[model samples]
Target: MSLGSAFQTLCGALFEDSMTLVCSAVVPESLTKKYRNRMISPRDPYSIYQLDSINSSYLLVFHFEDMPDCRTIQLTDMHNLNCTSHTGEEKNLYFGYSHRMCYNYTLDLTTELKHHCGARGYEENMQSGYYYTNHDPNPDIRSDVSGGSLLGSPTLVICLIVSLLLIALLHWKTSRL
Candidate 1:
């Protein structure tokens, strides 16, 4: 990559930030049936939850019993999903990126943390690690890429990748001259 091209990648990553509140769970067959193509309400704690800007990658270590890491749970790693829901059963959600660890209990998100999530029965799998991105559209533009989606929108990511490729190609051509 040429100088300008490299700068753009860095710049873009720095700017155009977005967020996504994704969630996962060791859901049972009963819950899985409901999750099939359904847009669940935030108050349903028994479902996969969503939150904002919590960072986690690879594994999300959920501790247990206030025992200081006595028990932990591991969650799979996926990019991220939009629909950042900071209210309801998911709020101030934390996450990890790649190699994370801990004693996480995959239980009690909906019935618990109702007050925390501003909803009554938010069954969030709060015990495991779940990273989220800052998707608030109105965040201060100058804020660093600290909060935004890694790949904001698939369409957007695709567009940016294409645009960067084009820019890099042009820069390479000019530099070659």
Candidate 2:
């Protein structure tokens, strides 16, 4: 049904090595290409204006070169999965064994522990709903985004009154002339 499932079937049929994982990570890269523009509004044909008078319309093309190499399972020397400390804790996960090499011995699981703890804390938020883009086609109906500047406060009211009076005065003067 899925790509992973198809891959599994193919691997089972052909290859001896067991298929492990297929993870994808995206990183932004600035790309530029030209194509035809198609943002025409059917409702208001007369309101259509040219972005560029010389150029008619163009499309932005983003090219994907190749599939990323992420099809492998790096075997680690995880001798013991379940381990315990000197003080005798309930249960411990054997992260990595200490090696007395020339390099620095920095084997701290505090980061990983904190990460898992934080993840657990966000269980409620995760259960709520999935995230979306700022420019999502169907934006949240409840949001009062407000396209332009809002007319609020006493200062704005006074300014508006003054403008109206000035306009009225100008019209009166023109009429008299």
Candidate 3:
């Protein structure tokens, strides 16, 4: 079977609903160059090997309503789908490598150029790996109690109570005088 057909079959079997293949291309030389000397382990969420025997590598991008199960994909020849990284609610990209002419896919979410894969049930998978590029209209703002509103801090509330007590004491003393 052609690599393209294999990918389509894999996706069809993996995802419950029909998904769209947004993009597919040969993995950029510049990107592959970065991993020339890097050691890739089977346990790693992503893998990049210097297999001179394989002439070319490809990157496949797919759009899905929900992420496919990482465990199920791990069972396939594609191996694990890096479940921790994602671009948006409905988009994911997979990095495929040629191993002895058969595609040995790896989930390369760490790459800066492409959107990462999302795994099932992992909340972190919903977050985009490219934080700098994310122009979130309603970004979450986290603040400590001290840095937040004055009424929200216990220390400030105690201080206000103490100040009020001190003022009452002073007023009572002046009225007595």
Candidate 4:
């Protein structure tokens, strides 16, 4: 079963106002603190906290404190979940609600919207999947070729010829010496 199901079972037993939801919300602050670094084993179903709070709009960012691969996702009107990574050292998620008195709007993470700073980064879908890292250029582009075939172009051919000629000249000079 997915994390959703485990959440349902645990929530039902723990909280009177329990509900099972996907990763589109929050895990209660209290629960998050309780299971800070606990590993969710199959035998120990309640080890992981289910973040299914659909009460407020919030932002959740997951990244290593020192790593550059910062992947952020926002959810609108979400419940709080208190779960951490298996190691409890790398994954960090934060949740906060809007305090603007006049603007009671919550931004949905699944929607295609730009940030306030004018940077365009939106979740492709409201579902969770593998995060695109800097190592993978053009994550949106997919190909079926294994190892990706390297196509030779005129520039590549010319560079190869130049490299070989330079190597031959160096070898000839060294031999004469």
lDDT of 4 at 28: 35
Estimate, for each residue in 80-99, the C-alpha lDDT of model 3 and write its tens digit. Answer: 23232233333223333322
Looking at candidate 3, what is the lDDT of residue 38?
A: 38
Could you estimate the TM-score for every candidate?
A: 0.19, 0.18, 0.20, 0.22
- Give the higher-TM-score candidate: 1 or 4: 4
Query: Model 1, stretches more than 4 Å misplaced?
Result: 1-77, 82-103, 106-113, 123-126, 132-177
Computed on alpha carbons, the lDDT of every model, listed in order, comes to 0.32, 0.24, 0.32, 0.30
Summarize candidate 2's per-residue lDDT along 78-103 as a digit string, tens digits: 21112122243323222222111110
lDDT of 1 by residue, 1-177 (tens): 754334334323211233232333322444435545142233222222222222221122122111111122222122222222333232222222212222144433332332332443333443333222222334334234543555676877799999999999999999999
lDDT (10s digit) by residue, model 4, range 36-107 = 523211121111111234322222222212221222222222222233332443332322221111112332
Q: Which ten residues in a row have the lowest lDDT in candidate 3?
A: 125-134
Q: How many clashes in each structure?
A: 33, 5, 0, 14
Candidate 3 backbone clash number: 0
